[model samples]
Target: MAITPPSNRLWWKEPIHGIELGWIVIAFLWGLFMFFFMIAWHFIGEQNLSTETYKVKPERYQERVEAFAAEFQAQDADGQPLEENGVPVVRPPVGGDAYILARLWEFWPILELKKGESYRIHLSSADWQHGFSLQPTNINISVHPGYEHVVTLTPTGTGDFGIVCNEFCGVGHHTMTGRIRVVE
Candidate 1:
């Protein structure tokens, strides 16, 4: 039913209900509580994203990614280089920097990481913005063009972790998935 104005002119003069007044006070208190809680969590939360970013040209970043991938490229059993969809599969050394480039529909250079070892993963986009979501660990960060983002992470579990794009980029957004293998 549509709301109608009070039929009586004396409606404004009526006393407020006690229950309504109590709810109003409770809501105000709850809002204040939540505001403080968020501030406290920022200081205590362990799942914070890294703020280390650098300005770099897209072409230069791509060149670095290619060189990193080639330096640590894994070989196949038949003596040829291993590649997935034309992108090399690399196994970076422990405590070293690794590079991953996000482009139109894929993330280049599948990474093989050793559990319990730390690695600095450099993430950047070649063309547009992309989302870097690491599964099981639930780490998510934004990948943008012309800026490199560095995240230092240590894998605690050994398994195949997926890197999925949470941002919608284009018609093939659903196909924008990458792989990371963590081994003991």
Candidate 2:
């Protein structure tokens, strides 16, 4: 008599049952739905501030910053050139662009904005990496010496917002503070 080998496949390895197959299909479809939903919300449904940014030599970027400061000098309530929190201030006109310099331990030129106006704020580091954190609203932007980081913001509330460097640069890192005032 000839001996035949048993089947190589286990019984459980047979084609999946209809109920199990249906569950797998449903799960796969749900995953696809979630993926597409996230894409739509990020690209369309949110107030994303993806500003137009580009790379430049640090020296070149600094030149632009100096020119911007000379152009939009800010003044205090007394009609004198303003100095907010001990740093120079720049209150650009409505619908205009603004610049802030993040160096070793200071953010040069505090920003003053209209409560309901929008601005294109460009930031760059003159020395090392820094973090631009605006309090109350809790907005953060990365500042690098050779790259320009741009962001758009419209202050809905009138108040003074604090700017802190979240990156550790040196001994005075803890005191690297700046401010922006939103007025009516």
lDDT of each: 0.91, 0.85
| Candidate 1 runs further than 4 Å off | 1-5, 9-15
Q: Per-residue CA lDDT of candidate 1, range 1-184, in tens?
A: 3288677667778888999889999999999999998989888987677889999999999999999998999888897988888878899989999999999899898999999999999999999999999886778988999999999999988989999999899999999999998999
Q: Best lDDT goes to which candidate?
A: 1
Candidate 2 residue 128 C-alpha distance from true site, Å: 0.8
Top candidate, metric TM-score: 1
User: Residue 182 lDDT in model 1?
Assistant: 91
Task: List clashing residue pairs in candidate 2.
Answer: none
Q: For each candidate, what TM-score against the reference?
A: 0.91, 0.73
lDDT of 2 by residue, 1-184 (tens): 2286446546576779899999999999999999998888888877665766778787888788888877787766797876656667887888878888898899887888999899988888989999999997768878888888878888999989999999898999999988888999
Candidate 2 stretches with Cα past 4 Å from truth are: 1-41, 76-79
